[model samples]
Target: MAHNQLDLLRQRRFLPYFFVQALGAFNDNVFRQAIIGLLGYLAVSPQDKTLYTNLAPAIFILPYFLFSATAGQIAEKLEKSKLIRITTAMEIAIMSMAAVGFVTQNMVVLLIALFATGLQSTLFGPVKYSILPSVLKPEELTGGNGLVEMGTSISILIGMIFGGLIFAVAGAQGPWVAGVAVILLAITGNLVSRAIPRVEAGAPDLRINWNPIPESLAIIRLARKQPAVRNSILGVSWFWFVGTVLTSNLPTYAEVNLGGTPTLYVFALALFSIGTGAGSMLCEKLSARTVEIGLVPLGAFGMSAFMIDLYFARSGAATAAGLTVAGFMQQPGSWRIVMDLVGIGLFAGFFVVPLFALIQSRTPRSELSRVIAGMNIQNSGFIVLAAVLGIALQRYLHWSIPQVFLALAIANVIVAIYIFTIVPEFLMRFLSWVLVRGLYRLKLHGIEKNVPDEGAALIVCNHVSYMDALILAASIPRPVRFVMYYKIFNIPVMSWIFRTAKAIPIAGAKEDPELMRRAFEEIDAALAEGEIVGIFPEGALTKDGEIAPFKSGVERILERRPVPVVPMALRNMWTSMWSRRDGRLRRMRVPRRFRAHVDVAAAEPLDGASVDAQTLEAKVRELRGDAA
Candidate 1:
């Protein structure tokens, strides 16, 4: 299995998916920009103009509310690669209609085409997510998703600028050109889909639900059946709600409050999308190929903080005159505005990627498409709500654009407060932050850079010391759930840390057969669903500082649910007091000038057919070079 995600993207399967999705994204923004630009230039009144632009998204997303459930069912029932082809074919038809609407200058036809395009996307949703698990190794999901996200956002920015500029340059012919481009893109996307290796139907007998309202509700109930799946979906939905509200209102704030032309509004959009792109890439780079939910809160915190600063930083309106994007950057106070937008976008990526990966990682493969359908349902609903709320703030409450920004920032606090109360794990992660703040943190090289940003992973390490768990836990940027020997689980004080980290304890055959059974079961369940499960293949901490003989437990776990096993080596860890043969074990009183210097060297995940304890141990030894 691939370690670095950048390497993964170079492959045919992933790149096609990436570009196809990006093309769809560009199509989305290009058409929307065309409509918004035309409305800006032709709408009779300013009031009607913003209403028309904001309202466009609601109408288009209406299909998500209408078809996500049915689409999800379709995805689960049919072959996904074929489903992608069908969706691309549908895009071609939709773009053709859009071209006619644009050429005839028919607003009603345009709206219909926009909604039609949304319908095509809604059908594509389930297959889009389901294909990741089907095509890429479990470890490749996070970074794969991250790259897709970055490319999509950049595509949006490029499309928007392209649409606006092209309309300026071509006027009446703009939409015709955009339509032909979209059709060509769709055809290319379909060809790419045809190249994807076959992924059979996940649930061939899955039933379809045609009605939107009840079907949408049922999808949520389906997700609710699994705790991790539900949390992941809820987290995913929350990100969308926050994102929709911010993105919907950004253009208005940029024009009215930031005191700039439409070009500046475009700049704000670009900056925010760019920031989100950075955050998405960061998730992969920081987590070392694991889906780390800890960063979710970190991202949320930055999002809220930056949003708040943005509102407060606004000097009400531009003092002297309007400024372009370049001029705005040069303005003394405007830099803060730009930075806040960038940070909010960046944090949004952090907030979004893991949540998505979490859903993929935690949800059962059988029902993954349905759960994704539920997530899309929530997203579409929330986007509608966000648009309504933003418009209502302006039209009903008579709030200025900046006032809406301030209110949304304040609302972030309330929303976070509610979600944390519901999910205490987010709050629990904060405790680690507090503890680490009082301690020194050791940095590892290419450790986070080497791992996939999403999906399920089984990490195997050589057992040497009791502190191995903590060393591995702290070293990986992601939240790792270690499967430790039962004896250590009951240790005083440390038990709480294990509980907080959600570590699972296991026992040997003679120690407790029943407990060992349960431990294996948990490991299987976690890996089968896509969560990370770390293990020490040596069975127990060595009596000597050297690596011990490999055991069969990890092999047993792999037998239950086959996945990639990434080997990691903790160098110099044996020299620490936690080493099995180091002078003292479990003695916290050892002298400490500073924390030990340990290097986490990662090896490519073992292929399932070739993976065994002996092979894995040898790889670990090679990674370490000399004995620790």
Candidate 2:
């Protein structure tokens, strides 16, 4: 539907939903920050302030652990747009109670309302992520999720700034200002939610389990059912952990390390938030509008790089005390610190956005809501653990903020390695992503439109070079089990990547009949499972940059399984380094077409039942045109 990520902002389907979610996040932060402001206004004892501040997060997060399972079922059973409206409507009631607490200066009432706010958020959680897949096409998931994350990041930051300043500017009128502001924001969210177009329930006829404990376990099991999805959920929780640790330390870090006033703490947070927002928005462009999980590894390493630098940038106390934001910026190594914070946030965005998109795209639609619910439960645990561990490391172990950061950076690398090791797809994708992007400036034509988004399909493409499979895989949004030549599949370093990608290795029938039969069996199994299978119907790389006669293997495979066949072409790859144009020894020579412009085009799918190998080859030839 939407060609660009920004274009979605102009459409009613996404725009209204985006604003509603952003408004809800804005109001949530405003309410919480206003409570802090209220405490300051009353000039409560530091002990009391510490008590409330510490207690608030636990209370807010508890509802996620308690009610998220039920919420997930409800989300699956109701129309998505209706569920959103109901959540926004609930927000109005919850924020109204918060308003009363603000005006009455009742801490008990405020805390009760805070719990209610968390309950509302818990209920909204599943539908928040689940609705995107319903409204957006597969190709739009990354961009759409990017916008949502960006909006949330910016909204929370701005809401904190606005809510925190209400007390400073309004002083005696602070309570009234906060009360009115929260209620108005809630109402606005509700009003905007009305414009979100109706989307059908993910599992309308499904029965709900009212029990939280068992349902929570069941949903978590469901989330972990797929290895990629499971690892992705873990990655998302890790992001939250890193975020909590990094953000929670900023106040102390600003004061102790930078020798800056309280205002500098906010300034530091603003930089991280802005960088995160920028990174979130950039996911679409970086991913080429696909659900590119390859960015996850890049993001993780980038985050670690910045965080480690932050420790070395200034590992000790400030040279001066009580400097303002401007004065801190004027100090030596200050710009490096600023760059580190922004870089950390920026990479954090790159890390999380693709994982969300992957979860949505890969999970079955009927179970997506509950899966998201399960992820929320795990995320809550991670946030709590990060908070506790951060405090313990600093308070009990006597680790400085910089030391904690350094530890976190190291821990991040460990976690990343563990996840990648368990599910090498993330790492495989990353490697292929780098190989393709580094070698060529690739462009796609009719891929999103012509390739099947779901269901088993056969893709027949002319084999131009050894890198064709990776290039095609990178260009296409969905995973394709390429039927690569067995030798290429067994190549020294590339073998591991191919095996990890689950590429089917085939031998020529004359060369090895048994292996060829086994390859066909695997191909059939993959197609039957509703997975895409790709074949170089030409059977080998073109020797003279011309299409070889299509082999009968495609027809034989199609006869056994009549799935749709998509004709695809890789252009300008024949002259690439891996192509047969250069002899073996000459292949080692320096590449001349580095970062060459390459095109991958897909024609509309042809019915496998009727199309023979020759017709498919003609179609691919047409798609390839004169590019080779």
lDDT of each: 0.75, 0.93
For each candidate in turn, give its C-alpha RMSD to the true structure in angstroms: 5.2, 1.1
- Could you tell me which residue pairs clash in candidate 1? 142-453, 142-454, 143-453, 288-448, 288-451, 289-451, 289-452
Each model's backbone clash number? 7, 0
lDDT of 2 by residue, 318-391 (tens): 99889899999999999999999999999999999999999999999999999999999999999999999999
Tell me the RMSD of model 2 versus the true structure. 1.1
Candidate 2 overall Cα lDDT vs. reference? 0.93
> What are the runs in model 2 whose C-alpha is more than 4 Å off?
584-589
Q: Model 2: clashing residue pairs?
A: none
TM-score of each: 0.82, 0.99
